[model samples]
Structure formats: C-alpha cells, structure tokens
Target: MYELKTKENDSSVIEFIEAVENPKKREDAYKLLDIFTETSGYPAKMWGPSIIGFGKYHYKYPTGHEGDAPLVGFSPRKAKISLYFATGDTKREELLQNLGKHTSGKACVYINKIADIDVDVVKALITQSIEFLKETYPDQPE
Candidate 1:
C-alpha cells in the first residue's frame, strides 16, 4: 500500500513557523496563520512537516486511492510561500487576477510574502476553497 506522507499530525504549528530560517518568512507565516484560521473558522493544524492547514476533507480517486487533505492550507517555503487552495473553481483565476503579485501552479499559489498579495483576496479564496471542498466531498464528516 502506498503511504500518505502528508497526513495531518500532532505537530506544533508554532514550532514549525519559528523554525523557518528566514525571519521575514517566519513572520509572514504567522500572518497567514491568522488569516487562514480566521477565514476558515478552523484552528490551524500541522500537515506534514510545514503545511499549516485549516479544516479537512476526505477524497477517493476513481483508482481507489483515498486520503484526507486540508480544505485550505499554506506553507512558508524557502523560496516563496505556497498557498494551498482547491483547483477547478472558476472564480480562482478571477480572484488571482486581483490577488496582487503571485504565481500559481495547479493547486498552490506562490507568493513572495503576505504584503505582496491582497489579504482580503486570500481570505476570499480560503472561503471558496472550503465551500468547494465541502460540496465536492459531501460525505466527509465534519
């Protein structure tokens, strides 16, 4: 069986943030912690080693691979902060268009810092991601 390495764990989110080598990134991590927590109304939990996640959902693929994932999350990476959000929402790109300076992969949005992106827009994206995930995986327990 394949192991899910990124499962949520009992790790301390604050300790992880404080360990970030970059002082500025560490500070931004706290800012994001507040943003995600307040926006999702869920306490932040450590996902894997560095991802600070809020809320969660379980998903099963057609191939039968299944696991739980954060409904919204972000990580303060070495190069840039990676904001995790649900893909496939039409409003995603629309909001990103106004989200200040940032780059997007399929699921992660990379930003230099919280100051580089609009905090309000980030909150909006978090809201949309949670709603989309709730609807997409309606069977997930609260």
Candidate 2:
C-alpha cells in the first residue's frame, strides 16, 4: 500500500508563494498564479506543501495506482520554478518548442523565471493539458 506524498491539501497558496526565498522567483510565482488561474478557469489551490495547483482529475493506472492530481500546477523552487502539466499529451511537446528558455522532464517543466518563457505558450499548454486530462480521465469528477 504505497501512498502518494503529493495529495491536495488546504494549505495557503499565497503563503507558499510569498515564502519563496528568492525575490525574483517569488514575483514570478505570483505571475504564474495569475496565468494558470486565468487559463484553467479554476482557483489556485495548494496541492502539497509547495505546489500551487488548478483543477484536478482522478486517475487509476493499470497497476492499481490511483490518485487525484492537479491538471496544472507549479512550484517556485530555489534552483528553478517547476511547472506541472499532464503527461502523454503530444501537444505539450509541440508547445514546449516555443516555450522559450526552459527545460522539461516527463512531468515537470523547469524555468528560471516567468520572463524566461512565453506566457502565451504557457497558457496554451495549460489549456491543452486540461483538455487532454478531461478526455483521458472522462470518468473523473469535474
């Protein structure tokens, strides 16, 4: 019985963003909050201790691993700001090409600051991620 560490919580998203050590990253976190909120049309919520998330979906894998996760989220870390989006969306890779100076992993996109990436592309990615998640996890709640 493996439990997921990053479950949604009632933590204060503003407190998390305001507590970011770096001033620039803190500022960028606010910008991202606005961008993600407006794009996803959902209010921001704290997914874990640090992640500011919008919207959510429940997913169950073939291996019996199932949990609810944010459709889009981000964290302002010390080294880099990590952006969370739905994996397995082909449009993600296509949009990342124009996302500007950023690096991405299978689940997270790392960016130095909001200015380092194109906000429009971020919005598009958020939109695509929500659409993909809705289509993929249609059985989940709205």
Candidate 3:
C-alpha cells in the first residue's frame, strides 16, 4: 500500500505562505492563492507542508492505486514557484504556448514569479486542468 505524501491537511495556508523566506515568493504565493481560488471556484487549502491547493478529485489507477488529490495547486518554492496542473492534458501544452516564461516538468509548471507570466493564461490553465480532471474522473467528486 503506497501512501500519498501530499494529502490535504488542516494546517494554516497563510502560515505556510508567510514562512516562505523570500519576500517576493511570499507575495507571489498570495497572488497565486487568489488566482487558484478564484479560477477554480474552490477555496485554497494546505496540502502537505508547502502546497496551496484548490478543488479536489478522487482517482483510481488501472493498477488499483487510488487517492484524492487537488484539482489544481501551486507551491512557492525556493528556486521558483511550482504550478500544479493535470499532467497529460493536451490543453496544458496548448496553454503553455501563451503562458509567458515558464518551464515544464512531469506534473509542475515552474515560473519565476507572477509578473513573469500572463495571469489570464494561468487562469486558463487552471480552468483546463479542472475540466480535464473532472472529465477524466467524472465518477470522482469534483
């Protein structure tokens, strides 16, 4: 039984953001909190120690592994801010074209700060991620 490390917790989302050592990261964290919340129409919650997540879905793999996860999230990290979106959504790749300056990973899209990217594009990414997750996991709670 594998454990999901990024489970949602009752921790203070603001406390985690405030603890970010970089003042700019802290500010960007606040900005992202609002963006994710407003775009996803889900309140932000603390996921694990560092992630601020909005919305949620339950997913089961073909191998029988299953867990609940945020529909979209972000973590303000040391080197850059990590934006979490649905991994394999073609819309993700499409939106990233207009996402301004950012780097992509398996699950996270990294950006230096809010100012470095187009906020509207981030909102689109959030929308697409939620829609993709909901459509893919329609049996799961949205």
**Per-residue C-alpha lDDT of model 3 across residues 1-142, encoded as one tens digit per residue:** 7899999999999889989999989999999998888889999998888888998899989999999899999999999999999988787999999999999989999999899999999999999999999999998744
Off-target runs (Cα >4 Å) in candidate 2 are none
- Per-residue lDDT tens digits of candidate 1, residues 27-112? 99999999899999999999998888999999999999999999999999999999999998898889999999999999999999
lDDT of 2 by residue, 1-142 (tens): 8988888899999889878888888889999999999899999999878888898999999998999899999999989999998889789999999999999898999999887889999999999999999999998776
Q: Give the TM-score (vs. native) of candidate 2.
A: 0.97
Error of 1 at 1 (Å): 1.6
> How does model 3 score by TM-score?
0.97
**Cα-based TM-score, every candidate:** 0.97, 0.97, 0.97
Alpha-carbon error at 118 in model 3, in Å?
Answer: 0.4
The window of 10 residues in a row where model 1 has the poorest summed lDDT is 133-142
Best model per lDDT: 1
Regions of model 3 farther than 4 Å from truth? none
CA shift of 62, model 3, Å = 0.7
